[model samples]
Target: MVLDDLGSSLRGTLKKIANAVHVDSKLIKEVVRDIQRALLQADVNVKLVLDLSKKIEKRALQEKPPAGMSNREHVIHIVYDELVNILGGSRELPIKKQIIMMTGLYGQGKTTSCGKIATYFKKKGLRPALIAGDVHRPAAYEQLKQIAEQVKVPFYGDNKEKNAVKVVKDGLNKFKRSSDVIIVDTSGRHKLEDDLIQEMKDIFKATKPDEKLLVIDAAVGQQAGSQAKAFNDTVNITGIVLTKMDGTAKGGGALSAAAEVGAPIVFIGTGEHAGDFEKFDPARFISRLLGMGDIKSLLEKAEESMKGKDAEKTARRLMSGKFTLHDMYDQMDMLSGMGPLSKVAEMLPGGFSGKIKDIDMDDTQNKLQRFRVIMNSMTDEEMNDPSIIRASRVKRIAHGAGVENRNVKELLKYYNMTKRMMKGLSGNRKMRKNLMKQLQFGK
Candidate 1:
């Protein structure tokens, strides 16, 4: 939910059109005003917001609806397209061998992003390696080494070395032969300092990186533009990596950071998990933020998260009214393992994602964890046939789970809710048929 405020507010603003019989000048003005307020509140640059709003207003008023499109649809298309252009365009990291030099201010998550970038490339069948050239930060080498381990990629660093330059040179020679891409993590400063800038320049000259990415934290808000400009001037950065986009109201600024330097945000870090990183696409991102959903990213995540898991078996069991608590626990594990719930929720269509806003995700996620604990305490027979559990069994389970009896009741309530919903949906043969075709479990 990057720029969560804008998502909820903008969607609401757009929904105002649904009640209207026509997309008139008055409706267009109202929508534009709402868009301005949403973007400004999200910490987007005031001038930029005004410009974008103006363009949206002009286009909505002037552009005729294309064939088979209604006036409302035309206006929506104008806003969507304009927003995409303001944010970014179709830009990508090189597919060929590359050396990526990561540079940013202190505490910008550059180190973690290095691992993310490496993992992204490795997943694309490239032999990737991480080079720890940030000799300034204490334990920087160790931190990146652990990340490289987590991502299952090769790492080269010299913890004992004092000169960051020497570290980069050695790491480069070590990884040059074996790796397809060598991502170098450089030093950072609390503020832009002469020494830090010079260090980055030296790293740039030494590595001759294909992409010098400035990893800016999304919380920096509209100030991100200035930071992007400074970094680009120093090392001539080629792209941006806006990190910690999830849960940040100021994500709008980070999304626009590249606009200041004529660079593109190449990737975005949605969550802290290694698997949470995504290749940023302006069109898909704008679509998701506006509650239109991103089917491509959704399908990609599904394939990744469900890999080697028995999805076919689960689907059959669910349709058969046999998805027991044990199966529920397994399903929870799969979802939790995929990434954060908010990220998964955004991939759902507008109709469903809108409803999810009413849910307290934190509470729901906590309940999910509690459910796991309660299920862990349950016996195999009890989990398989929850209907057999009586009051005494519930109390015993609560005691074993170290939770209140009421909490156990809540878990049961959730389990039953899920059961009913699944049964209701499974009852529709056409629904089952469509879902099976989409999942293509055997195919």
Candidate 2:
């Protein structure tokens, strides 16, 4: 759900393309104008927006639709490609034995991103250590230390020592023997101060980091280009990290500006949680933005939420229409691990993300939690076979779960509805196969 406004606008424009009778010059111009308006509203640079509009218009009018592809599909394809290009082509930070130094102005979530990057590499099977090089702010040292503890990674820092270069030098020696990936969280200023530049250069010299990432807040708008350039001039930034991308309407400006400055966005922080950060994949991002869905990312989230064997077992049980309340509880657990329901819905195909915008996701999550509590209050027999739950039992469950009787009944109703739906799916072989294909089960 990052840049939801822009996504909604773009999806609206694409919807018109789908509804058009023919892909003529008039329709192409209209679509281009719509895109330009959306990008401008999202704070994209005027020049970049105009250039992108021109490319999309030209491709739509001049490029012939491939064999078996319709004009509408061709136009959509061009839009997707150009959008990806402006957002910068896909680039992922290598997950290997290396050192990465993080830089940025203060309040850009640089220290926090250090922990997120460590979590990312750690989840990728690398042993990562966090080094707190922000010697100027005592709070930053404590913050990174806490984040390191929260992520359960090795941390090195010296709150008493004022020299950040020495801290990085010592931390590298301390963790290099045990860790594969060492991440240094450098100090930042309110603006690009000379002292901050000197500190960055000194740390760069000491660590000789494999990657120098500049973190910028998406709310900074087009100013991010100048900021990225300043940091790149000092320490030669290898990539960029855009934080608070989900909260800002100016995310388009930040993305395009960073790309224009020649810094590939290697990672983006979609939400505050460490798990909410993800590698920047321009194609998948544009696909989600256009409401085309990102099945690959959805599958990756599923795989990350649960082990392969457990996922396959659950998938088979659900497809076979033989799951119990215990299975349902496990399902809820997996869904919770996959982050917010809205984010998961974004990856669903067929413009489903647009429809999901209408649902109250927080209420849905609360209801699921209530269901879990109600199931927890039930006995094993009652869970395995809901048929035995009479009025007295429902009353007991409601009382035990600290809810009204209607809540228990509602849970029961939902369970029955789900079972019936799964039963219907099990009866349809083709539909079941397609569903499994989308889920990437057993693949």
Candidate 3:
């Protein structure tokens, strides 16, 4: 929620354009000033903000709107594209067999990110192994080992070993044949100390890792650039990883600072949970940041929750308007797999996401669980067809689910709402067209 306010600020600025009948220089300047203020508050470097604002202004005014697009749309596109560039253009790390070395100042969440990366690779069907090369930090190996066990991946660590390079050597040899990706978690000093740099150099010589990653804390703000440069001077970071993205209000600073260094960010830790980690897609990130839900990311998380023939079959039924309580239950249950309710809401475009902000995310999640429990108490025939569930059935189901009869009625209402919304999509041409327009306008 750090950049949440920025989205509102940007939206308010852009909303002015929506009301304007003409695209004028005055309007452009106003929007640019609003952006500058928002970025500055987020701790973005002043010069970088001014430069980016300049580019946005020039493009919005000088460049002709694309064919069939209005000036409002064109100007919004320019802002979106420029912001994406400022956060580093889309850069992907190919999922393949490789060795990655993790380095950063102490307390950058390097160890947690190590587990997250390994878990991410494992989910992608790669056999990932973690090497605990951070012998300096107490319980560092234990922390990663616990994560490895939870994610069920191979892990190698030696707590007593004083030579960090030896740990990397032994870990590589230990999982050479069994692992597709080997991640070396190296030690970090409180600051950029000589000993820590030398230790990293020693590990670099020992393993010659395929990629060196610098895990950065998003709260570091403008200092992120200097930290990135210092590490890149040594091992030459192949990519950057930002942690605690969900908590920091100065996330814009970290993002812009890292981009200033021209290092492509590979992954971002949105929350403390390993499941909250996601690949850093600049375009989608900017989309979410601007309040124009990231549907692509939403779909990706959806696929993770429900897959194979069951998911396919459910989709078919919903499209055909054959939705049932069972279908609703499965859909809501699948949502649990997608990090948090508010997080998932941010990926949906338009008023829907704004509505989510007004509600309690945890309370919503708890209600979803209650819905699932209520449905579980229903008979197969009743779940398949809700019409048969009269007052008697509602009372019985509620009693079984440990709730009042009114709760059952509320669940039925939610199911009907979902059914109508999903089924109406087939006939809602105007709604679909409006959504397309909003998505193009950055919502």
Residue range 1-443, candidate 2, lDDT tens digits: 89899999898888777656556899999999999999999999999999999999988888866644556677888999999989876678876899998999988998889889999999899999999999998898899999999999999999999999999999999997899999999888898988888788888889999999999998999998999888887677899999999889999999899988887899999878778797898888889888775433333454344354455555567667787887787577544444323443444444545545544455666778889889979999999999799999999999999999999998887667556556766787776676666666633
What is the Å distance of residue 371 in model 2 from its true position? 65
Query: What are the per-model C-alpha RMSD values against the true structure?
Result: 24.2, 23.3, 22.4
- Candidate 3's displacement at residue 170, Å, is 1.2
**How many backbone collisions does model 2 have?**
0
TM-score of each: 0.65, 0.66, 0.65
TM-score of 2: 0.66
Off by over 4 Å in 3: 293-443
lDDT of 3 at 124: 85
User: Which candidate ranks first by lDDT, i.e. highest?
Assistant: 2
The true-versus-predicted C-alpha distance at residue 35 of model 3, in Å, is 0.8
Candidate 1: global Cα-lDDT? Answer: 0.78
Please provide, for model 3 over 92-123, each residue's C-alpha lDDT reduced to its tens digit, 9 standing for 90 to 100.
87789999989999889898898899888988
lDDT of 2: 0.82
Assess candidate 3 and give its TM-score to the true structure. 0.65
